[model samples]
Target: DQQVKQNSPSLSVQEGRISILNCDYTNSMFDYFLWYKKYPAEGPTFLISISSIKDKNEDGRFTVFLNKSAKHLSLHIVPSQPGDSAVYFCAASQTNRDDKIIFGKGTRLHILP
Candidate 1:
């Protein structure tokens, strides 16, 4: 079984609108949740993150929310821009265990201009 899961294969949104991506995890040991954006022919770049101690974390237009009880997490982008279109991966790590992180398959987001 996959430790991290992104049920949605892809998402489409209009520019200047909001984009939401969902993810789930089976591991309760995960204390840190992160969102990474990846472009073609490039590695994933960190976008936002939330620690288990906090329910939400935000940075500029990007925000990440974590529901530990439900083992669910989500990333929200406000005023989505065309430049934001990319594959987003949800990752989780148990800091106490090791530095290794588990990542979801990823969801492709398309921004319509």
Candidate 2:
């Protein structure tokens, strides 16, 4: 079973539009959630993060929401730009000494100009 899964492998949207990415998790023990954006060969950069303690968190054009009961989370980007095209990965980890994170397959977002 996939502890974390990004159902959509890819998403496409026109520039200056809204982009929504979905993610789901199976493990209930995961307390820390994070989203990372990747461009080509470089490693993913931390976009935003939310603890299970909060329902939602937002920063600039990026926002993350967590639903503990449903075991799901999603990322929303407003007025998506062409430069925003990249792979997004959702990760989760337990809040303990072993902060090993589990990542989803990733979602490739293509923003059209």
Question: How far is each candidate from the true structure, as Cα RMSD in Å?
Answer: 0.8, 1.0
TM for candidate 1 is: 0.97
State each candidate's clash count. Answer: 0, 0
Candidate 1: give its CA RMSD in angstroms: 0.8
TM-score of 2: 0.96
Candidate 1 shows a clash count of 0
Q: Where in model 1 is the C-alpha error above 4 Å?
A: none
Candidate 2, which segments miss by more than 4 Å at Cα?
97-99
Model 2 per-residue lDDT tens digits across residues 16-89:
99999999999999999999999998989999999999999999999999999999999999989988999999
Per lDDT, the best of the predicted structures is 1
1-113: candidate 1 lDDT, tens digit per residue: 89999999999999999999999999999999999999999999999889999999989999898999999999999989999999999999998985789999999999999
Could you tell me which 10 consecutive residues in candidate 1 have the lowest summed lDDT? Answer: 94-103
